[model samples]
Target: MKLAVIGAGAVGSSVVELASDHGHSVTAFADSSSAVIDSAGVDTAAVLDRKRTDGVVGGGAPEDALSAEYDVLVEATPTTLGDAEPGFGHIQAALERDRHAVLANKGPVAERYADVRALERESEGSVLFEATVGGAMPILSTIDDFDPSHITAVRGVLNGTANFILSRMATEGLDYEHVLAEAQDLGVAEADPTFDVDGTDAALKGVIIANVLSDDETEYTLDDAEVTGIQEISGSALELARADGRTVRLIAEVVEGSVRVGPRLVPDNAPLAVSGTRNIAQLETEHAGQLNISGRGAGGPETASAVLADIGRL
Candidate 1:
């Protein structure tokens, strides 16, 4: 497939490298850093180095790059749901041109899932976003297999950074700040880290999952959901978990019409107890019972693998 990658950050760069490795022709790479985008098809290693040096990151504007025709357009930019002009505009342009879209970015889908779905219907094109939720894990596809009416409840540790921090707090007795710094050093947390540390990241994932689990394509809102960041928790919470043979994890759940995202003390025997850095998600349904998925939650190679899988579907 001829593809266009609309970001050159960690995920986008990984997509470009993986697609190119799979023998797919990467038509254009759009990023603020012209040097990085230009070097996408040439020297990926150097492009990564330049990105590190320049810090000109996030999803690149797709205005100019989308003008060129391509079979598929992959959106891997950093998410900001409220404003979709540049990002959503690029996806719309691809669909308008009858090109398939594979999105790894959550912003467009989280804020405008209904509109984007309608656009896909009108354009007769597909928008696959397996990487958006669980990195390479196939949570979305599993939900797609069953009838929405059969789904009873959805719950899991949706944010890996929070999970990792909690896990470290339990194991090493480290405070939130220390574990967060460790996560950043390990590349699990972004430099800003607000989305992961706070519950916003998990809340967005809940919105997407709720949409998939709902019978109707009703617009899901994050307003009613209770969200709390792991930062609010003290190291003493981890100590309490140890006293009770438990560990704290940032859990998110969508049951009926209500959704909740917050840090919870999970029993030692719980599946969440086994979840490590960037891993874990579970879906419970009337028919399917309980299905669990766990893997590297955030990483270039894992996310890139998902983009490649979507490209294969095209």
Candidate 2:
């Protein structure tokens, strides 16, 4: 597939760098302000080098890549709530042109599921977003394979930043602020760290999962989720949980048309009590009993791999 990638961030750049390895060509690439286009294929290395050195993907307007030659639009833009602008609009442009849309951005699917599906219904293209829920984890694809009806519920640690902090606190008896500072220094947590630490990122993933499981019977948005952050989780709480043979994880649970994300207690030996920056998702199934899927849940190359897998599906 020929891919047009928007957003020159880590995930976008990874997709551009790895597209050829996945048997796809990125025909156009864009950042927030600029773009590079070619009917044949964009020079991936040159474009990425320019982005590294000059801080822009190319010289053209960002919107130009939306109209460039491509079989699929890889929407890797920064995720936004509410309107989910630019990302939603980019998906709209692709579907309007009858081109497939493979998303790494969770905004459109999480916040505007019905709108995206409505557009897909009228277009010849289909939308797949395996990268949105768990980076490189194949969470959505597995759910689709099992058939959403067969899956009873989905719950686990969906945010690596929050999980790392909790894990460090529980294991080392470090305070919340200290562990968070270590995480930020280690690049596990962002400078702001609001979304990942505040449960918004995990909630967005839960909302997307809920939207998928709904199968169009219901539409889910951030407003529908009950979100609780880990900001107030002190080391003493983790100590208490540890004394009880349990650990705290920022779990996102989606079941029976509801989505909830917050810190939850899990047994120390439980699969959900994964350490460091790893992520785990437990799927309750009707026939299969329980299924555990775990791996690196966030990173550029990790997420880009998922995005490329979605493109291959398209």
Candidate 3:
């Protein structure tokens, strides 16, 4: 497949870098301001290096990549809330032309899933967003394989930054501010981690899961999710939970038509209690019982792998 990748951030750059390894070629690549489009594949190495040095993918206009020839549009733009614009518009362009779209952006699917599906229903194109929920963990595909109907509920530690802060607080007997500072220094948490630590990121993933499980009878957005962050957690609270042989994690629960993400106590030995930067999704199946999928949930190549996998499925 030939891919037109938008958004020159970590995930998009990774997709451009690794696409060739997966037996796919990138015909077009773009950041916010520029793009490089070629019918015959673009030079991935030069483009990436130029981006590193110059901070732009190519000299061409970003819109050029949208109209460029490609089998699939890899929408890896940063996840935006509300209307999910630019990214949503990009996906709409691909589907309007009857071309496939594979997403690493959570905005379009998390906020406008029903609209995306409605567009897909009217076009020859199809949309797949395995990277939107869990990076490299195959959560969405697992749900699809089992048939969403067969999966009773989904819950897990979906945010790595929040998990890292919480787990470090419990293990090191540190306060929330201290652990959060360490996490930021280590690049485990972003400079502005409001979304990650405030449970918005986990809620977006939960909302995506809910949208999937609803199967079109219902449509969910972030507004529908009940969210809580780990900002107010204190050292004493961690010590208390530790004394009780339990740990707190930011758990996202999608069950019985509701999506909730908040800090919750779990047994230290439980699978949901995974530590530092690791993520786990536990699925309750109707007959097959519980299934746990765990791995690095956020990173460039880790997430790009899921994006390319979706292209393969396409």
List TM-scores for all candidates, in order. 0.89, 0.99, 0.99
State the lDDT of candidate 2 residue by residue for 1-314, as single tens digits: 89999998999999999999988898999999999999889889998999999999888999999999999999999999999998999999999999999999999999999999999999999999999987999899999999999999999888889999999999999998999999999999999999998999999999999998987999999999999999999889999999999999999999899999999999999999999999999999999999999999999999999999888887
Every candidate's CA RMSD: 3.2, 0.7, 0.6
- The sequence of per-residue lDDT tens digits that candidate 3 reaches over residues 189-233 is 899999999999999999999999997999999999999999988
Off by over 4 Å in 1: 33-62
Where model 3 places Cα greater than 4 Å from the true spot, the runs are: none
Candidate 1, residue 286: how far the Cα is off, in Å? 2.0
How many collisions between residues are there in candidate 2?
Answer: 0
What's model 1's TM-score? 0.89
Sort all candidates by TM-score, best to worst: 3, 2, 1
* Models ranked on lDDT: 3, 2, 1
Q: What pairs collide in candidate 2? A: none
